[model samples]
Target: MTTSEDTLESHEVGLAAPPGEPLQTLTAAEADGLELVHQWFPAPLTVRDGSFALPPEPAWRAVVHAARRHLEAMVGAVGRLECPELGPLTQCGSAWLIRPDVAVTNRHTILSLLDDVQRGARTLRVNLSAEADGSAVLHCPVTRVLYIDPIHDLAFLRVKQRGAPQVGLVVVDSIVTANPVAVIGFPSHAEGGYAEPEYQQIFGDGWFDREGRGFKRISLGRLVSTSDTLLEHDCTTLGGSSGGVIVDLVRGSVIGLNFGESRDRRVNLGVPGWVVQQRLAQLEGSI
Candidate 1:
């Protein structure tokens, strides 16, 4: 979907922190986590046939091995959806499996699809994979739009499961400032003039597809602040990152759902994990 300037401006207005709240500095552990992320990617190596070239350094390989399980979990849990009506290459947004047959994403991302479903269209599908060899891709048809959150940007969907792994969730009560986190999803160009240049610098020219979008990748940052229902983080995100999970690097569990960003891109916003848990519980009870 095309993101208008007005839409981005609205995000800035709503996500901007209340005046006078100070930003927190990263702790030693947080710094170590961020350093590990840097070591994992290093620089824009190259892209071949829509896949990234592995860094050959033994040290880089060691880091990958150390974090392999978490990294794999990130990619396995999150998947991208495409809606031809939205645009041939327009990714609806990132959605992560919460249950074998249930997924969560931004309401805005599936708004058009919701309309189409009402008119008897059934074209939505989620493409998921757990292996880098392209050997285990799972294409699950989205059966229906389960619910559109009345207050937040969250939405849920029912998909035909084919062994998709669900991500573990940690309630917000356990999260704290300076906890290092990562956002995993498909990121397109940053339309707000915020993260595009940095993305280009880090990933290089070969990183994007013909339509200028990057594949599943991890962005590292630490939680800056939180409230009853919202989480503010500095994780670099773009247009298509909506609904991506904010995972605690140390715990390897999801703590938030990405939804919006400040105009400056320094502050990204997400629905707190507890809020998501509560919503899902309500939905389950009603069903």
Candidate 2:
């Protein structure tokens, strides 16, 4: 809730949440709750970039706890193949789900699994864990798949899992010049994944135009260079967070999908929400 314009790295060092809480799983009931909460706000929350600046000790611990709790309900939606059985594999370099009810992730994540399958990997498995404790659950079947951009690497999957809580879909919205934004996802390095969020204020906010909406990456710092981008405090994202929601906190809506980060490891790039809308619409049509 703090607002600042500083880019500081907030490290998440802690234990993960357990996966036993039925309430943590995405469900219709939870979706209703989110809708109710959205109605209370006039606009979605806009995210900006800045360090969370934990006050040291337990407070930082609380932050880490919150992040782990969030991840507990998230399930990894992986690709499957039948030629050979390689058992279940994790998107070791990807993030968890944005909404638990429906497991969504960067299309490339699933694609990567497919790549492995073509290379003689067997059985694509979706990773699901309990929300209360980080208990590992086996193969959560994927019932549906929705891709926003065949080329852009965005996809949403309808998975079948027991005890998932009701979840509301985060819809993308129209863009405005210099709008505020926030991202909620698990990021990580090649070494491993982190449960914390990677928050970056679009120093300047922009969106994907209709023609250019396919698969594109927008640089957060570049926006700041072009226009005004509002940022928030203490948000840092790591690996294993692909396909998480980049929300308009002020507007209470989603603005983009977390795809990748900067090479220097500073700015975070997000795919605009409008593009997500287009892809979702395509999904609905195909369905």
Candidate 3:
């Protein structure tokens, strides 16, 4: 147990764990949980070479099918934003790809794209692909300027792509207070990529509290606190991962999109779905 004084000192330095230790280490169970969750998705399923092909049991198969449908709802709808003036953008730092959906990252992750486009880039594209590795894809060109919210640092793009999901754009409504959430996306230049997403559940209710601004980005205690803007949960995300979706496990839907990680390395802030939805709605009338 740590004292209030220790907590204050740690916060002063923006560290979550004590010296010489890291925050959010995965236990054996947590690691296994992530793999199990991914197995529930079918399109991403593949029998690795030399691995034993154990047939999924009847009950397990049912679970997998259901999970796959829900995940499709979350991953199927992605926003593609780009500016040709900046050159073909690559998934580098804090950027990544998930099958069938090329995510347009948050303002901080790909600010250059936004800046150049606003400055009058003649062409821009947002493509949704079929693999996390960016294999087999559908490209969407940004033909019409949509909505943008500076306060929330979010934007919407009306893409031009053939055979896209009928839905305009979907976002997560809310996150479970003390349940699990998963971040799905590709990483920066990772060759041996995991076929499916990683899932991590919050063990307790620990939150990021900064004045009345109330950024929720920690999982501790039993009272799990949350914010309409920021989100806090126990999951792993890294470079090339900025625009990925944060799915609320209980709801089986995306609640947020990864934007930035806190200095503590324990929390990541996401653009809430409500913000994304509001921007898109405004664009509908204009379009």
Cα-based lDDT for every prediction: 0.62, 0.36, 0.40
My TM-score estimates for the predictions, one after another, are 0.73, 0.48, 0.55
Count the clashes in each prediction: 0, 59, 13
Q: Which pairs in model 1 have colliding backbones? A: none
Q: How would you order the candidates by TM-score, starting with the best? A: 1, 3, 2
Query: Per-residue lDDT tens digits of candidate 2, residues 75-174?
Result: 2222111112432223322323344535556655555455454455433334433111233444455555444244544566665555644354456466
- The candidate maximizing lDDT is 1
lDDT of 1 at 281: 90
Candidate 3 lDDT tens digits, 67-165? 554555544344333343444343322222222222334554334455555666455565344232234555566554454445554444455556844
Identify the superior model by lDDT, candidate 1 or candidate 2: 1
Q: What is the lDDT of residue 274 in candidate 2?
A: 62
Q: Write the per-residue lDDT of candidate 1 for residues 170-235, one digit (tens) a residue.
A: 434368565567676666654435345544455544444566545666665667677776777766
Model 2: CA > 4 A from native:
1-89, 92-102, 115-139, 144-148, 175-181, 189-235
Poorest stretch of ten by lDDT in candidate 1: 1-10
Candidate 1: deviation at residue 27, Å? 16
For candidate 1, the lDDT comes to 0.62
